[model samples]
Target: MAKRKFKKQIYRYECTMTGEAFKTTREAPNPNDLVSVKAYYELNPDEDDRPEEIKKQLQTEE
Candidate 1:
């Protein structure tokens, strides 16, 4: 099926000065706004749910 878009979704952003990356569903700050994000992208959770990785981690910890 074709991908779908949601009104509010996770967005990944990087710090212009620190290059630190973070994700949030709230509105992302502009590239040069106070938070100083250098770049960002929509992080659709469905595209990378990684169920296998989660299952493996859970098994290892058990």
Candidate 2:
């Protein structure tokens, strides 16, 4: 068994918990070190898929 190393590429990412954005090296940081988007989707699989679904709801509400 061996460990996989991630490429160091600078990019902006948001803190899912604080809503604060910043730049970092890793493309996919450790979920334990940060937050997991997959957790939210797994917990609420049926929730609206954001801007698209949310926009549709607003249009229907108009």
Candidate 3:
């Protein structure tokens, strides 16, 4: 007797920004599975500078 092999199928998706593509399985993704993709543009300052920076910004806004 001989055993048989099965072929699995795959699905793919693309990112709107970079036009880069990737693959996925399980047919379709659920609404909850989708993630928000955002870019990080802010940098953390030194610990001492953080408090003063926040205070200055708030005071200027007032």
- The root-mean-square deviation over C-alpha atoms between each candidate and the true structure, in angstroms, is 13.5, 12.6, 12.5
Number of backbone collisions per candidate? 0, 0, 0
Off by over 4 Å in 1: 1-8, 34-62
Using TM-score as the yardstick, the better of models 1 and 2 is 1
lDDT per residue as tens, model 2, 1-44: 99999777787766566565667666764533554454454467
Stretch of 10 with least lDDT, candidate 2: 31-40
TM-scores, all candidates, are 0.36, 0.30, 0.36
Candidate 1 lDDT: 0.56
Task: Estimate, for each residue in 1-62, the C-alpha lDDT of model 3 and write its tens digit.
Answer: 89888777887665544455666765655533433231111222333344668768756995
In order, candidate lDDTs are 0.56, 0.62, 0.50
| Residue 9, candidate 2: alpha-carbon lDDT | 77
Clash count (model 1, backbone only): 0
Model 1 TM-score, all chains together: 0.36
